[model samples]
Target: MRKFLALLMLLMISMNSTAGLVNAEADDPVLTSEAAVLMDTQSGAILFGKNAEVKMYPASLTKIATAIYAIETASLDEIVDVSEEIEKIDGTRVYLNPGEQVSLRKLIQGMLINSGNDASLAIAIHLDGSMDTYSKNINEFLKTNIGVEDTHFVNPHGLFDENHYTTAKDLGLILNYAMNNPDFREIFGTKQLEWDGESWDTTILSHHRMLKGEIPYEGVTGGKTGFVDQSKQTLATTADNGKLKLTAILLKSEYKRKIYEDTIKLFDYGFAAFKSSQIRKGETFTSGNLKFKASEDLLVTEPVEKGKRIVDKDGILRIQNGKGEIIQAIELKPLIGKKPEAKTETAPEPKQSGLLSVNTILGVVVLVGAAGVWMVNRKQKKSRRFRSR
Candidate 1:
């Protein structure tokens, strides 16, 4: 009878304050796409997903990586000599002649804005001297720097290959990381660019209907579109609703409109249901009659819930809500009364080296390349941070 009474008291405490955890039981959105994911760009928390981690062909959406990679590694103003090979490439083209000299930046604009397969070929050849080197260098860039694991690109233009694929969740991570690059964001969000090409003389427009304002969305900041017979349709988009920023991806949609409709629905749900909350490192809390301190800045976007902290005997802290659901968990050291250590200046900690800066992803460190892109080695964990203005 005494034990039952003790359990009841704990239940009462859980109902009253779930250790100050963000709690929201928002309605989950239904999506029609075969695979989709919606995530908080800032908090790195996934708001929703369907087959998020499942591999699927990304089609031309691969250009999102290609465009950003070139922007970071290549000298944009330098001229690249177009090869006759670019002309023979199938699919979209800006129709470069056999021996045309075009700026690297111009080719990027052509590839991204026009979805020019030929232009992508030119870029691959110019940057690394051949398709093989481009493939190796780009894969290295994505793996080492951006921290995307589930994605592997076989082609710069995302032309369908059996091995070219990525998950919607992975795409969200890549987009979020890329958005930190000002140059990449500017190009990704651009609706159109003026094209003065050897064969085509007109303003090249974005294929994304929403980004072009043909299908208006209120907070649409950036987007990429892709299609191939095998991958069907793929899209990556970013939206900000003043309070929260979101990165959403849809891949392998059977219908063209399905991807767009799913994306808009996700934005609507995310904006309406989620809000960002943060808890600083070393902030103390008591739950289950135990004391704990936050390990890092705990950031999340969720429906407001009365939070409570609960700790087990092993010093593991679980931030939960009034309903006893686990929102997030962090390891806490035993709270002991001791004199605070003397302050001393120390070198800043190196940025996290992971495939994704998933704020709560399996205890990974906070990723720190928000203002730019960084290159790191697979065997090396330190960020070689660089910002491109």
Candidate 2:
């Protein structure tokens, strides 16, 4: 009977803790794309999202993940031998003939600049020996490195495979994570390259109109485009306006023009409506009577109008917009000292002493077990921490 009562009290406490977790929702932009997300590159905060979590085809955006994984895993100077499989791969190509030799650095340039499926396949096979192995490696790579949950890439090229799919949120996360790498930023931003391949030898230009100056947009850094019968049109773009760095992912647009329009609208909204806010190192916040402090300087994205910052009892800081809608939540380190609550003195009864002892033992066992499990998991999957430069 005592154990049951104790368990009931724990459930109530857990429910109460989450009661005010969600605040008022802020107004979001209207987009024509089937799915879209606008993220702040510095803080990894989602400024805007429309069906962002919905699983959809990611077309050439898969290459962003592939390029970064390869760049970090293999030496760019290593030469890769092209196999006959390149001929079988369809869609865009750098026109590499079987038995042709190309440097890894050149393959990445061709793959990203020209959206070459053949280049992607060659890099995949060369690194992992087979497409199946490439799929497993990249999936694990994204999950472990980029911390993506809703992405599964069966091919490096993002060709139409029924099993190959990713969400706009995941793609935004991937691109933001990749942009941090200097090598990836260089290749991804290249507007044009003089191609000298086995079969084709000419200048190749970026398919992203914004990056190529065809669709003029200031601060356009890097972009990738993808399309297939099943996936429709997909676009991933990055930009910086001196004050802010932003990443936009749009998926399953019916027309090419619509995606670009959507991307521009997102940038305009992000730059105009949001700004970065910071918590200095050692800054303290209070929730009820508990206190927490920032272990390091922390950056967050919020509306330009200055959102309300609320700290929860668990030491989480939630930044909310003017309408009281949560824009971002950051974890803070709890202070070591917390004064215990004052208790009312009561006369002890001999008859109830045994029951009190049993309840105390039960509670201690449960808490110790829970804490041990949490510690083990925390040690195993420590999340990557980011700080402003």
Q: Write the per-residue lDDT of candidate 2 for residues 1-389, one digit (tens) a residue.
A: 99999999999988877764533233466789999999998799888899999999888888998999999899999999987899899989999989899999999999999999999999999999998899999999999999999999999999988899999999998999999999999999999999987679899999999999899999999999999988898999999999889999999999999999999999988988888878899999999999999999988898886578899999999988777778788999988876998889986765767889899999999999999999988866654332221
Superposing all C-alpha atoms, what RMSD in Å does each candidate have to the true structure? 28.8, 26.8
Global lDDT scores for all candidate models: 0.81, 0.91
Output the worst ten-in-a-row residue range by lDDT, candidate 1. Answer: 380-389
Worst 10 residues of 2 by lDDT: 380-389
Candidate 1: count the clashes: 10
Clash pairs, candidate 1, are 18-307, 18-308, 19-307, 19-308, 19-309, 20-307, 20-308, 21-307, 23-305, 147-355
lDDT score for residue 191 of model 1: 92
> How do all models score by TM-score?
0.73, 0.79
Candidate with best TM-score: 2
lDDT of 1 by residue, 1-389 (tens): 99999999999998778744435455668887899998888766677789999999998888888888888898889899997777668888888887799999889888877788998888888888887788889889988987888888877898878988888887887788888888778878889988888777898888888889988998889888888899888888888878889999998888888889999989988787667777788887665677777677877555554555567877776655445656445577666668988888896988876654554563433244422234435323443333321
